[model samples]
Target: MKFNFDQRIERRKTKSIKWSSEVLKNMFGEEDLLPLWVADMDFLSPPPVREAMMQEVEHGIFGYSIRSEGYYQSVAKWMEKRFDWKIQKDWIIFMPGVVSAVYYVLQGLLEPGDGVIIQEPVYYPFKSAILDTRCRVINNQLIEHDGRYEMDFEDLEEKAGDPRTKLLVLCSPHNPVGRVWSRDELNKVAQICTKNNVVILSDEIHHDLVYKPHRHHVLANLKEEYRENIITATAPSKTFNLAGMMSAHVICENSEMREKLRKVLDKNHIGMQTPLSMAAVEAAYREGEEWLEELLDYLQGNVHLIRETVKRDLPKAKFSPPQATYLAWIDFRDYGIDGKVLEEKMVKEGKIALDGGTWFGEGGDGFLRVNFACPRETVKEALERIAGVLNKEELK
Candidate 1:
């Protein structure tokens, strides 16, 4: 065991959103609720990442720093060695975070009122980012057939064909629903968007966390034409638990698209890359691979624990094991309750906080997204609280 998955760390009152009293009160309306909603892991990052940050702190001078070829090489090599995607140094553009990157992409690619397509029950920020820019959100809701999610290509094609629709924000290894899009599925998306002249923005933030046998193919790397039409946002945040470091980067092969994005970044004056963040990112990709492999093993165990508990305790709930990421998409529609009612019960009655399925927009009702990236005990505790409430509610 390279790392201890059961190690518990106290985060309450640390200004951690997942554990903050004020944030919990605001989000779940309970100051003392146990939060399992945020997408970050409760585990410590890799030792190398910690050592790099410590070394930087020992120097005692946090000054402005510029990214060097080594930083770019770390990213390029990681992508090549891990995902088989050979990208160049020039293709990388550092951003504060993936959510910020989405804001910039919309600002660059679309004018006001232009339509952007996103699959429903996706990561909520995609919709938030689009609307924040005054862009119209066009929904291509995913279809769940027999507990597996598939893209609605017929609907996607129709949406893409609309001239008003200029961008499709794709969540590969999708969130909340957790189905890693297959190669053929991605090919269909590429073809449809290309045929309809819609540019594709693939958020591969969860790219490295895919579970076994479910591979993630960088959409831009699939074809030369696809490369020209795609802009990908990726980070070690989700992969290495570095979200707090505020470091993410975009990969765009199209020179013009890159230029447009750069213009938006420049307009916002957003390039403030910290020295510690740069160190952490490079160390994570260069030295954190082994830790990540072990972390995946731990996450799978957490997934299994939740699945079994749901089956035994909350018998009516439908839990389709996630193919990737630590998030689980659980369907509780059989309880015949709206997502809000289910979410409130989990928060107020169960005393556990989870992301409501309705927050993911249409088709997300009657589901909840559980982040099982914490220790096994935490997963069990949250499920037990949820089980008591759900079981009692079922008897009503």
Candidate 2:
């Protein structure tokens, strides 16, 4: 209520990848497309983050920075207050972003020919990171029941048991699908990985954006043994809509594994955080909690709008209610349209740019991932465009 989340800030001329006209033309084949494909929100960063960065800018000195003790405390306090997971300063290491950290972990932990397991249809970067590192991706495809998604535990266990499989990438509160893994589900995953000697690299980037009724269980918080075997990659970037700041932290409890990962970063010459980024991350974790709560409320409203708009206008399209994150995974199979075809129509006919389901891999076919982190008005407009495209075809 105190913050104005409904204000529409124009990003057209901005260098934002999400709003760039050139990017729009390339991705959607239309220069006038309304973008909802990227995960970043259209809102301004939290006041605390903005103010902190401003203060940092006021100082003329722009120099390389090392993360301070205050930075670690902020993260530690955030983990303790929000997730009830107590993390020590020694357990944290800074990386520019989650995707970068994922690759670094793969390089450090696995051989070039080793296999890594990931659940799909999930974030594409998880697969790309594996492939780029010369590692094999063993997909234990997720099971879609009704509108919800669940892991195929048997397949995961078997894959983990394989000698070549050395790591498991867990997308906590998985993107696209938006199902926040429950404690029991996470326990099952950890147990299987632990039993098979597969280290877990849990990406909790969307951890802070979870819906109120559903809790986010930190994979490492489950048990000491599990914690020792896991590495968590998280940041304030996703939470504060500051992805461009490019700073994230890797939480590792195992000293040996931490040392190995750090060595990889050193060998690659990769441990510098921009002053602005450092200030933003520390301020976000320490003072942006209230802003985040309000943001979640606004996002929940947008989610309802999309779900209701689809039901009333399209009738056939279905969405699984998201438990975490502002991203909505919509199943368009009822329309009997192919993914690529639907994507084309959404842009050409609807003027809306959405992420096609097929881009996420097999089970993603006939689906769409909509980012609902914008204003309620924007979400309504995007959903209306989608509904118009689908409904018009039905009338014929």
Candidate 3:
């Protein structure tokens, strides 16, 4: 490998949320547990990203700054090269993060009583963004079959065609149950949204992290008409472990829709991107390609490790190999343990913290989302901890 992905760098005393004592207590309802719950990777950012940030810091002008021309060009070039999608400079709107952009879009595009549709067992924030903005949530739950997840197009079309439904929040290459939507799935979704007059907000934050043999379909790239109705929220934050920097790009092909979102951002007075973060975005997209490719290869190895370990040690465990993202959704239903009970056992007995299923939403029970973007040894240890807990062995 070209990168040192196995270096076990310490994050515990660095004000890390995943390693904080209070966070451990609050999240796992226990202390002194090894945390693997949070979605962030434990690996260092690509070398180019770190070097760019350091160079920016050396200049010593830490005042508020705006994204420059090269920043947009980098984004454009990335979209073209990675997704084969051409984006105009006017289509790009800068935001602090995808979550923030979601809130702003809801505020600007929908009214109090308008309904927003999202697939169930999705990122929990989609529900919060709607409710917090006084909009209604209409869930079109995905279908889980043979240990995999797929969208329910019939239910989606039924709900989206409703007069009150105005928007759809899509988690591309979805989070917990890692299924990257195929081209056919995306086309169906776009057609449904268009027929129902629903606007589409495709959260492609993890677009760059897809595994081999399966490709990520950019919904807007499927058709010209789809592009006009879709707003794509993408960032290097997820791909390069730069979420702390909090810089994301929202691509809206329609001028009016772009203006509406920009207006909300303007009203909130959010006009600054830290100099280091700005530089990091450019560097990650432009020079971090090789590192990213190597990272994906390492992640694929982690996936195989989990699959083999589960089958050998915990035969009842079932998981669908993820097509994208570093998160693994493992079904522990065959163990006959409730989600909360297993979570407690894992933390208290095994001393390892993992995300319990219920956090994602209904139908998530009996499942656990494991962040596998760590050293191979760490992955092995976490799984061993879980298997030992299942066998009634207490942590030593």
Candidate 4:
């Protein structure tokens, strides 16, 4: 089936957080700004998923539901088919979302005041989850050299060795600045965490969205020893544009660790799934591959457009096509504008809303994260707006 990724769908007044006028005003201080900040895509979901959901709607009796054998099989098969990682049905556990899974894991495994290591310029919510659980955040910041990002393994080892540090939250194919970790990097990280007896919460939510010539390794699937120490969070949300469905999975191979996390979920009454979400997730995994392949091709085109536009129009800016994910992290430091002021100019003068680099924590200043998972026309307009704001003489 040929997917029309270029078609522009109307999202306004659809209760979309990304397109809501009120949300834009509150978030960017401009009600009419062109929004390209949020991670959700502007394209419609796959036809099979929509049809499955419609079947559920036609049934007309929405009630409490339990996942069936087919549901688990779909998830297990996806892992095997996509990554060559064979996973058992029993290893999967349901969660409403990855962020909620992070909270639950912290609550279940670590006590208050314990240290959790996270790479900086990472997803902002990782910090929030740690602080919300009363756990201390230990920053093992990423190293940037020549417009590319790499892990600070020496720093990671030092932090993981701390007695107070009990967990490490890893953003695989990391958000904000996307670089898919190679097998060697994953092995080194696993060795350090396992040696120090620290649990690794490997957030592989963006695993499926990686581009060609770059592969995302499932930390647990790399080695048996790593499996015992890793808890992976995944979802069809990013892959299938199903974020509103609120369905995600937490895979734990170790029985004891699984029990601990399950206890936390059980205590909070968090295991139920919505009938609609179940249909959507199952259909996505079982029959959405054709749609996904075409979507990736479309997204890669957008990536190239951004790269070319930046080089041609904004010569002072620094950007590279991300190895994975739809988010593009571009540095505007050469413009000599403060990060806050640059973000303000984007919203007020350029009439665009993008994620400020500072929001991702340390090492993020003087940068902006642009989400390009929209129509090509939308991306072109956003690039023009960005160039208009940054290329102005007054700002420089």
Candidate 5:
């Protein structure tokens, strides 16, 4: 099916967290700020997903629902087809979301004050989950050079070797400064984690949205021992824009680890899946592949649009095209403003809402994360507003 991704859908009055004025006010201290912040896409989900949900809704029976065998098979098939990572259906466990799973893993697997390792300037929730669970965060900051980011194995090895460190949260095809990790890079990570007995929680949520010429490697599929020690958290939420559905798939080949994580989830009473969500998950994996391919093509176009606009208009900023995900990480350190100050200017002067670099933890200052999964026009307008503020300051 040919999808018209260029069509802009109005979301302002729809009570969307991304588009709601009240949400903007709460998050950014302004109700009318133009939004491009949240990770959810502004684009409509694939037609098959919508059609399946509509069909489920029309049935009019809303009760506790279970994911069918087909649901697990769909996830398994997508893994193999997209990443060439063959995973069995039995390893799949369901969760409401990836962020929540992090907390549960912390609660279930580690003791208070036990250390958890996370790469810096990563998805902020990893840090939040650690602190909330009373665990100390061990930072393995990524090396940034010439606008490219690489995992610092030296720092990572040093941190992982800490006897108190119990888990390492790996954001494969990492967030913010996007980097689809190479297999060789992943192998070294496995080696270090294995030597120190650190279990990996691989968040491969964006595994399917990678741009061409770059591929996503499922950490579990790399080696048998890696598979045994890794717990993977994935979802159709980001891939199919089903975040509101609150469904996630946690895959673990290690029975012992899976049981530990599962116990926490059971204690919290998290097994119910909405009927609509079940249908959506099945349809997304089985029928949405064609739509996803087109979305990636459109997303790549959005990436280019932001790259060129930042270059031509926001001359003081540095942006390298991300290798994966719909987020573009732009560096404003070229302007020499505090990261916090630049974030405020983005809202007050540029009249746009973006994720401040500091939100991602260490090394985020003087940077911003822009969500580019919306219509191209929205991205263009945001860049123009930022340019106005920066250029006006430049002339002063």
Candidate 6:
């Protein structure tokens, strides 16, 4: 069945965080702004997933659910088929979400005051998890040259070498600034962490959304030697728009490391799944590939639209098209607006909600993370609103 990517589904009345009046009012100080923030997509989930979920709803029995062997197999099959990682069923562990899994890992593996390395500008939750776990954050900031972001492996090596740095939270196909790490980059990271005995938690939630000509390498898949040191967090949430399902997987190949994480999960009572979410996740992995392929094409078109709109309207802004994920990280430094002021103008003047760059930590200033996982028309309108704010005579 052909899906219509241009269809604008009504999300306002629904209990969508992305479209929530309260959330917008609190975050942006305006309830009526056009929302392009939050990581979840505005599109409906795959038909198979929705149908599976409805089937469960129609059954009219929500009880304590046990994930079947088929459930694990589906996840294993997806990893094998999509990324050719050939993961074993035993390697897969469950968490409600990736962020929760990170917390569990930190609590399970490290002592308070140990250091965790994270690259910035990155997903802010990594920093939150580190600090909340009572660990120090060692920032290995990504280097951007001419709008392209690359890892500073020299800095990573130095940071990883710190005896206090016990874990490295890596965002593969990184968020906000979306550069899919090449195989070489992944190898260097693995080598650095492994040599220093620093456990790597690779958040690959955006793994499946990478674009053509750039492939996402599962960090654990790079080498067998690296497997023991790497823990990967994945989910159908980002891939299938199943965030509300609250199902995520953590793949740990090392028996000792897996057991350590399991203890944390058990201590926190973390392993539980809704019957509907199980059905949805299983169907999504087993049958949603066609829908995903179509969605990617649609998203690519949206990316192009953003590029053209930014170039034509916001001439001073710099937007390098993301190699992966639907988030567009655009630089507005040339406008000479402070990061806080830029964000304020975006809410008050532009009347649009965006993930401000400052929220992503160091090097994020004077930027905005625009989620373009919506209709092309919506993307165009958001860009127009942004242009209006930045192009204002007073700002210039």
- TM-score per prediction, in order, is 0.99, 0.98, 0.97, 0.98, 0.98, 0.98
Residues 1-396, candidate 5: write the lDDT tens digits. Answer: 288877889899997999899889889999887788889998899998999999988998988877788988888898888888888777888888999888888898999999899998999989999999999999999889988999999988889988998899999889988999999999999989988999899999988889989989899999887778899999999999999998998898999988988899889898788899999999999999999999999999999998888888888899999999999999999898888998999899988999999999999999999999988888888888888888887888
Q: Is candidate 3 or candidate 6 better by lDDT?
A: 6
Question: What tens-digit string does per-residue lDDT give for candidate 1 at 190-306?
Answer: 999998889999999999999998899999888776779899999999999999999999999989999999999999898879999999999999999999999999999998898
Worst 10 residues of 6 by lDDT: 387-396
> What is candidate 5's local distance difference test score?
0.90
Compared with the true structure, what per-residue lDDT tens digits does model 3 show for residues 116-212? 9989898888999999999999989989998878899989989998999999999998987888999999999999999889999999998998998
Q: Count residue pairs with overlapping backbones in model 5.
A: 0
Cα lDDT of candidate 4 equals 0.93
Cα displacement (angstroms), candidate 1, residue 119, comes to: 0.4
Go through the candidates in order and give each one's C-alpha lDDT.
0.91, 0.91, 0.89, 0.93, 0.90, 0.93
lDDT of 6 by residue, 122-233 (tens): 9999999999999999999999997899999999999999888899999998998899999999999999999999999999999999999899899999998998999999
Q: Where does the lowest 10-residue lDDT sum fall in candidate 1?
A: 220-229
Structure candidate 4, residue pairs in collision: none
Candidate with the greatest lDDT versus the true structure: 4
Colliding pairs, model 3: none
lDDT of 6: 0.93
Q: List the residue pairs that clash in candidate 1.
A: none
lDDT of model 2 at position 333: 95
Q: Which 10 consecutive positions of candidate 5 have the poorest summed lDDT?
A: 1-10
Q: RMSD per prediction, one decimal?
A: 0.8, 0.9, 1.8, 1.0, 1.0, 1.0
lDDT of 4 at 148: 93
Candidate 3 error regions (>4 Å): 393-396
In model 2, residue pairs whose N, Cα or C atoms come closer than 3 Å (at least 3 residues apart or on different chains), thus clashing, are none
